[model samples]
Target: MTTALGLVAGVLTTASWLPQLRRSWRTRSTDDLAWSYLVMLSAGVGLWLTYGVAVADVAVVAANAVTLAALGALIALKGVGRGREEAAR
Candidate 1:
């Protein structure tokens, strides 16, 4: 049951980001994404990771680990890309 739930959660969260990620990649524009939100979200994910570790929950740890990395990548790339855009202008 726990494994099932983990599977569901993993699929749901990963799939939820698919559309936005795809669009951002294709358009090469994450300007619509809010930096503040991502910043806060990354912090929250960090907390989630810590909590998962404290509780010794593998699913929580694994999911948050992968998600945190992905989200962090997006945030970094978006900031860098935006900066480049500003400099180019």
Candidate 2:
């Protein structure tokens, strides 16, 4: 079952972000993350989500949706922390 395989792969890939998300939340800092990279990644993930929806692929939709949420949280944390970071300098 390719669908099962895809779901497995999706889970793995989606789970990979947990560490980073945990770290970011714990530290409340995204200093090591670049704005450009985040934007690009979000864009790509968004596209994947759109494609998944368009084609009705549950695996892609589920994976990208979760990934996008994580990315959104990361971006928000990064933006909020930026002010403090700059003020510190």
Candidate 3:
């Protein structure tokens, strides 16, 4: 039961990023997103992944892995988009 609960919580929190990811991909606009926030979030998620691995928790491991992927993509897109904007100027 605890594992199940953990999975549910993980899914919910992980899914929270889906919409933002989709929107950013579609629009190629991360003007509203903060670089500092994404950097810190990715760092924090990395720590969570490390903790999950140490603790051998499937839910934590799975969720943080997926989240880190999403965050990575978002960060890449933001960087590329910013670069293009700067190049245009």
Better candidate by TM-score, 1 or 2: 2
Considering every candidate listed, which one attains the maximal lDDT? 3
Candidate 3 accuracy as lDDT: 0.94
User: Where is model 1 more than 4 Å wrong at Cα?
Assistant: 1-3
Q: Score each candidate by Cα lDDT.
A: 0.83, 0.93, 0.94
Model 3: per-residue lDDT, tens digit, 1-89? 98788778889999988998999999999989999999999999999999999999877899999999999999999999999999999
Best by TM-score: 3
Which run of 10 residues does model 2 get worst, by summed lDDT?
A: 2-11
Q: Once superposed on the true structure, which residue ranges of model 2 sit more than 4 Å away at CA? A: none
**By descending lDDT, how would the candidates be arranged?**
3, 2, 1
Candidate 3, which ten residues in sequence have the lowest lDDT sum? 2-11
Output the better candidate (2/3) by TM-score. Answer: 3
In order of listing, the candidates' clash counts read 0, 0, 0
lDDT (10s digit) by residue, model 1, range 1-89: 98898789886895666676677777778888899988998899899999999999987888888778778777877988889998999
